[model samples]
Target: MFAKLKQRWQDTRTIMKLSLDAEQRALREGQQHPGAEHYTLAALDLPDGSARRVFARIGADPEAYRAALANRHTAALSAIGLAAANANVTPAGASSAADGLAPPAEPTLLFDAQPSGQTLMQSLPELQRRLPAPLCGAHVLLAAAAMAHSAAGRAFKAIDIDLQALGSAAEAELRAAIPS
Candidate 1:
């Protein structure tokens, strides 16, 4: 009898694992903290493939997403004449995101935490309360979809992605992931 009940509540392992993976992804991108883009990148690599399918359904080459993400950051940084080909962007006197530094006096872009990134991370606690327990890759996809005006969004648009379709696919993926 409890087996049926147990199945209804998913464990937090998925979220925890995803979090670690997101952080690792951020580190690989030379960021001190995981941001929305890193989370989405990690989610696309989830073993379940739920997020991957959602993206593929909308014609994204899932495998190329990592490179695309990196390229977005590269393009953004390069636009300002920074040598951004190599993603190791930490510079001396740069404020670590962990310190909650105020925006730079000069126009600057923290590609790591794109303008929309904090909002995406901030939404997690509330999303946890509203979404099913043990949020999965699909949930990450949903969070990303919410950031439609972000760098990741711009990257997708450059590739001719249909944002509306992406949002719909994210919803469908999440619903399918929940146990009935």
Candidate 2:
């Protein structure tokens, strides 16, 4: 029983680490608070994982998705007459790459701002209840999809991807991956 508890504790720690990584990415991008979109970006950064498989099954490239997300934010800023290039964003730490899953070289200091109305934090409990022992990138993606009104959802819509179908496929894959 103690071993089981230890394993659970380790899993929780891993999840928190990943969450922080996502938050750091958002902070580097000039976001005061990390949201579903940042979570999705971090999930895509996973070197090899279920999240990438889900993207493959849905015929979406994670790299392209990341670029599109950046473009979307840029366009939004442009619409507001703000120059995206001049945005006061910090460069990533040495350990954090533009397109890699490495952890930041130094700890990132994030603001105390809350996430947007639609964020993975709101859906994580339900997702954890549905998934197996260790939650992973795929779980994050699933949760993001569940929040259809989220920034990630809007991004998916903008790219003409049917989120419902993607979510259904991800669910099936997750179920299949679980051992009876």
Question: lDDT of all predictions, in order shown?
Answer: 0.62, 0.66
Candidate 1 Cα misplacement greater than 4 A, ranges: 1-11, 85-118, 122-134
Clashing pairs in 2: none
Q: Which ten residues in a row have the lowest lDDT in candidate 2?
A: 90-99
In candidate 2 the C-alpha lDDT for residue 104 amounts to 30
lDDT score, residue 148, model 2?
A: 69
Candidate 1 C-alpha lDDT tens digits along 1-180: 785456334434565566665665555445566667767776777787888888877778864665566567767678888876343453211224432432222222332343465676567556656655346677777777777787666666667767778878877776666555
Worst 10 residues of 1 by lDDT: 102-111
Q: Model 1: which residue pairs collide?
A: none
How many clashing residue pairs are found in candidate 1?
A: 0
* Backbone clashes in model 2: 0
